[model samples]
Target: MNKTAVITGATSGFGLAAARRFAAAGWNLVLTGRREERLAQIKDELAQTSVLTLVLDVCDTEAVQAAFSGLAAPFNQVDVLINNAGLALGTEPAQACDLAQWHTMIDTNIKGLTTVTHALLPKLIETGRGASIINIGSIAANWPYPGGNVYCGTKAFVEQFSLSLRCDLAGTGVRVSCLAPGLSESEFTLVRTGGDQEAYDNLYKGAHAIQPDDIADTLLWLARLPAHLNINTLEIMPVSQSWSPFAVKRDQ
Candidate 1:
């Protein structure tokens, strides 16, 4: 039987790339995204594979449960879940950042991720088969940068949460892994900068950042690994990206 993988944020970026990779590998996919048109497009694109498209906002707690409860037959039993629906809003310092943006990040990245995981974990355990939950995180979680604020904190929660989950699900054979990528160019920057094209280009112009496909390929490898093998956490960065010197305030 072909395995099934459910990916959130399937409209674009890592999520979409992972969905395509999964389909190509002959896995059935349940794709969730906020954009109906994009969801439809992806569904059509993955027509060769079993694709169940759902227009969803992960932040909507009620909708998350509704979507899962409504899953029919074979799709209901998910073998792998890719929690790729997350974002970073605004590139301003914590003191200068908008509270609303902070709230949005928390809602989607932290609350939303946990919401889906909480809802489906029981089912994953019930399957009594090897299962995995891959949470999408970022370098911001470990190394702080200017204007990171709540977005960094949210990702930190993801990495930490993944570790804790592995402990809880240790004996159950439910695998947990967190994929953290650094300096990747995608809709992420556009969303963070609120669609400033110039800003987006400037940040990635010379940086050969890790592509969405790179991350997707990594995800596939993780999921395909033997059930006895579990990767607790894996972090990747573009060759052009690295740690920066600590910022220090000096007397003017």
Candidate 2:
């Protein structure tokens, strides 16, 4: 029997790429994005596969609950849930940052993810063995840097929550995994930088940053793994990316 995968933030980046990857593999896709036009375009481009597009902002709790609860037919029998609808706002340090931006990150990255996961648990449990919840986290959750304040915190929650959730689903056949990627080149940087083209360009100029397709491929691998196997957490970073020495400061 063919499987179904639900991908959020499917308008662009990793979510869109994963939708295409799974579609190419003959999986039914339920794609949710805040942008109606982009969702329409994706629905058209991936016409070869079964596609259901929902204009959804995961931050809206009622909308998320309603959308998932309302899935029909094969789409309702979801095998994989890709929680990719997340973003980082300003790069300003905590004290200088807008409190609103902090809340927005918390809303989308943390609250939004959990709401959808909660809404879909019943469906995933119904699907039983081989069911998977692949949460898109960030290396920021593990490694802290300047200006990463709230974004880091939210992703840390994603990582920890994925672990805790795995414990809760122990008896069930549902698998929970968190993917933490580092230095990816996508609209994510543009969104985080407030559409600053220069900043986006400079950040990835020669970094050989990880691509959305890479993450999508990884998701496919995880999804296609044997039913008896479960990968709890996977961290991916491009060869060009690595750790930096601890910052040191001395009084002048």
Candidate 3:
């Protein structure tokens, strides 16, 4: 029987790329995203593959519950759970950041991912054969920057939560991994800068940031690994990206 993988935030970025990759590999895919039209477009693109689309906002607990409660066949017993529904709101310092943006980050990045994982973990455990959970975290979890305050915190939670899931799923034949990417050229900067095309272009200019497909490839590798091995955390960055010197204030 072909395995089943449920990927959240499947409308774009790594989620969409991963969905395409997995479907091509013969796995039945259950794709979820907030945008219904985009989800329909993806479903059509993967017509040859068994695809089930759920239009949902993971942050909405009621909607999430309702969507999962009546999952159709082929999506009922999920084997791979990809908790990828997350985003960063604003690139502002803590003090200068908008509270609404902060809350949006917390709601989608932290709360939404957790809620999805919590709801789907049981299905993975129930599989009892071979299962895996991949959480898309970020390098911001470990490295701090001026404008990465709360976004960093939320990813930190994701990294730690992924570790905890490994401990909880030990000996259950269920693997949990966190894939943290340093810099990526995608809608990330666009969304972060609130659709500022110039900001998006400037951020990726000569940066050669990792592409969404790069992450999708990593997801494919982790998901295809032997049931005996588990990668607790994997961090990747584009060759052009590296750590920066610590910031220090000096007397003017």
Against the true structure, candidate 3 has what lDDT? 0.91
- Judged by whole-model lDDT over C-alpha atoms, candidate 2 comes out at 0.95
lDDT of 1 by residue, 37-101 (tens): 99999888889989999999998999999998778866878899999999999988888889999
**Which run of 10 residues does model 3 get worst, by summed lDDT?**
121-130
Q: What TM-score does structure 2 among the candidates reach? A: 0.99
Q: For candidate 3, lDDT tens digit of each residue in 210-246?
A: 9999999899999999888899999999999998788
Candidate 3: C-alpha RMSD to true structure equals: 0.9
TM-score of each: 0.98, 0.99, 0.98
**Please, what is the whole-model Cα lDDT of each candidate in the order they appear?**
0.91, 0.95, 0.91
- Model 1: weakest 10-residue lDDT segment is 121-130
Candidate 1 has which clashing residue pairs, if any? Answer: none
Q: Quick one: best lDDT, which candidate? A: 2
TM-score of 3: 0.98
Q: Estimate, for each residue in 1-252, the C-alpha lDDT of model 2 and write its tens digit.
A: 689999999999999999999999999999999999999999999999889999999989999999998899878899999999999999988999999999999999999999999999999999999999999999999999999999999999999999999999998999999999999999999999899999999999989999999999999999999988999999999999899999999899
Quick one: best TM-score, which candidate? 2
